[model samples]
Target: MKPGIFKPLKLKPFRSLFGAQLFSDLGNWLDFIALQVIVAYHWGLDETAIASVIIVLGLPWVIIGPFASVFVDRLPKKAVMIVCLLLRIVFVGGLFYAPNLYILLLFVFLKGTVSALYDPARQSAIRMVVPDSMLPEAVTLSQLSVNTMKIAAPALGGGIIAVLGPKSPFLFEAAGFVVSIIFLLFLPSLTSFEESDNRMAETSTVKTSFWKEFSEGIKHIFHAPLLRISIILSSAAFFIIFLYDGLFIFIAKQIGFNEGNFGLLISAVGAGSVAGSLLLGQWTGWNRKPVHLMSSSAILSGTFIVAVGLGGLGFLNFPPLVWIIGACLLGLLGAGESVPYGYVLQSETPKQMMGRVSAAAMSLQTFSMLIAPAAGALLAKQLGASFVMIGAGLATTLLGSTMLMIIWKKSGSFQPIRGKQLDG
Candidate 1:
């Protein structure tokens, strides 16, 4: 259901932002795979060590998330993004000559920390530039590009590595970051929301403590019923699905897949995601968000993951075709699940507070995911990959259902905003 061509990327600021983001994302995929390969083959790292490198990359997102939101709100959105892109260029460039694992890890940590600030700023920028009517389509287009890169980038990285060497990907990534920085440099400063009257007054008259601002954001999320439900549901979803993050490689290995097939399996999900984002973009007339979320939550959470577990049951026995089908099915489920999530976030939060609220939501989501990879890895090691998948699927389904029930009782329907509200 995607447009024949990209729906004209009309807004100048959005056009520039999107262009910058696309190149950066592409380069990031390249760098990540290249770095991992360098660590594994060139440096002779074990699986655990390679995983440690990945963990270090994600650590900044976890540790810096709350504080990042505060800074994102205070800084000029475009400036924040440009600075982050430039920092990445420098950090990634350092790896070209040094090319050492410990140094690379340090760079990754800094990149991740900076990314935590940039992401919120970018999202807030989107809210500022895109008109409300076009927001959904904008989100779809952005997601499509991300998913497409995810599906295609690794293969491209692999091909590059095969031809040039592991270091080639880092150099390519560095160049991509530079290109992103170039695109960002042209972005206008006007594409950002101004601080609300209350916030501006406080900033002007009273110098508030950083912790106070941070805690206020946290309290606002918990005290606001809609945000409360959104965070709760999102966190639950993250926790339940975290198991899959943990067990993916293990599952592929159990089912007689090599690294190539594992990459394909991940790509299958991206393919499905692309398909789902397209569908959501085309079909946009939901009156009842809560009901839709509640119903879909159980169905989406349990169905494909259960299928994954079911398919993996024959891991010791199944043919290649069956494995392929299972991967496709899982992909379909992943695609279906993502569309409703964006609407839930957009409709549930106030526009002015979106940056901090979004950060809070993401922070909780990360807190949930923090345990998923390790737990999934441990479960796969102890029980069996299939069992972990099944357990995760069921846990996610149950949690979603429980959250949905709470929303339904409190709100009477799944729709976060009324149809009349959307019309005006």
Candidate 2:
């Protein structure tokens, strides 16, 4: 039987790591909102300037992720995580006094660089801290933490900004990092986990050059059929889905939603994500066929996206609440898709190479984010916003179905990844 959502908290190390991750992720959302408020409301900057800030924040993940993952693999993950948090605390704290946009951008870049290093290390550490069987539960809880913050942070940040001013959220963000660091200190050392895993020792002593090691990580990913296909499908889904990121506001306006109602529309996704993650956490059977679950959920999410797009275009003149219901359904399927795929990545990868593999996966997602908005904007300009959203939905549905067919043909059945199933 599946354990409850709180089952993983029984492990002290996981508890500590999860707590640290919660605070850190909450701080990230807080800082994101604060930055947007500072740029748009406080400084009266245009959308172009705001976009530049976001691009700078994400650039390191695209450019430095693979290279940074090399060091993540070599270093002590706990120490690396601590250092990343400390650096973020400093950089975001500086945002409080960043007299101008130039200084703010510099701090954002530095924080992004630190985050690029932090992410792979943290992902690697999760495998070390928890038993393999609990990986899906651990990932689910971690995602729940993220989605919880997604639902709460904007409102919290907005409240703080309203009461205390734009710079106040930065102070809270810095404090969150401090709390995260304190929680991280309670976790067992990464060295202890590494010493226990002889495979990790064997891999670490391979004595390859830095570039060779990095190249091996890339080659390993592509040569593994499951990893390659899963990563590509997941990345493509994200690329298509995010094409509506910037156009959501326009869609909301077309649907006659006020700013307050628009917040509800966005929050509906977070609410559904929380619900889905919790539901998945309590259900143990999902591990049996993660690929199938992922593909199926992607298709469902795409259908919901199409429904919302069509509604916005006046094809289905439902009430605004109905549209919000569709958004919730989209969010629910999104969680269903992401959680299983994350479990696949964690459970399938060797512990020794987890950092590099996770980094490669993250880099692909980051690249998608980098391009999706621009593509969405250009396409919306030419084809109309609603049509662009419809196109994204169609692309997602097609991609998911195609990936499912490929998987079915290769295995004759949707078999779980057992011993050496993905060996090249």
Candidate 3:
């Protein structure tokens, strides 16, 4: 039997944690818009300067994520989360008084550093709170919350900025951290076997070096074939899909869409993401192999992306409504890949190494973000935005096909770890 969408919410700790994360996610999007306005409009920065700001914000995750996860594993996950949130609130609040672009960039980098700790700790904490059987639903619902915010927060931030001021969104974001901290305070303490058993073993026996512990995480990921394949495919998919973010404006213009209608494209993706997550949340078990499911979704998503490109090139000749529908279909298929991919990571990873594994996975995604925009922009300049989109779609389709073939040849079936097998 399938679980209800609300099934994970029935767990008290998960319920509170989910609520807190929802507020934080909303504040993040709000702050994202506000910062863009401050950097581009208020400060009169050019495109290069704005891109530099984004690079600074993302650099910490790529550089510091693995080391940060070591602390997450050593400390109590809840304690790390609360402290990280408090630090984030301070850095976000500092954004209000940032008198110059450099100062603002400094604060954004600090906030990103803190978030590095917060994210892995939160993922590890979720494992502690819910039974392994419920993780897929929990992850799906969590993704749903994020997508819902993605759909709404931009509009909310715009309204707040218009009514209040440019700095209002940062203030709002700071207040959200306070609320998130309050919720964290009500949660119980959580400790993994590594934290408890390993700590005692380290104290009484020989202590493991920090480098050794960190290296273990890297080794674990690469050594596990299934985990390794998923990470690579996920990173490739992210790189391909995010190319659109850099080229969307040009693509929209080619399709005869004004700036206002461009927003509709983003909204369509978010709406489809919500629907896809909701569907996955209720459909208890996915009886198919994880790799097959993931690759198939990628294929479908890439197909839609190709369709969107063809529409822009007048090959498809899609009307505005049809174009929007294609974008929604792209998003829907994207969720089909992403949600299951997340489940594969969480379920396959040992509880003790959850922080490290999650951090590593996140770093890969961040690295893709750090490069995708620039690559897309350069390609769009030479080949045109329509061709860039088509190229990305074709690349994604090729990647999925290759992975599907490899997985089928190496392992006829890949079963996700559940219950007791998960702990192994």
- The ten-residue window of minimal lDDT in model 2 covers 415-424
TM-score of each predicted structure versus truth: 0.87, 0.95, 0.95
| lDDT at residue 335 of model 1 (Cα atoms) | 45
Q: The CA-based lDDT of model 2 is what?
A: 0.83
Model 1's TM-score against the true structure? 0.87
Best by lDDT: 2
Q: Flag the better candidate by TM-score, 1 or 3.
A: 3
Root-mean-square deviation of every model: 3.4, 2.5, 2.2
Which residues of candidate 2, in runs, are more than 4 Å off?
1-3, 197-208, 412-418, 421-424
lDDT tens digits, residue span 72-95, model 1? 776678888888888887877766
TM-score of 3: 0.95
Q: Tens-digit lDDT track for model 2 on 283-328? A: 8588877777888888777787787688779886878888888888
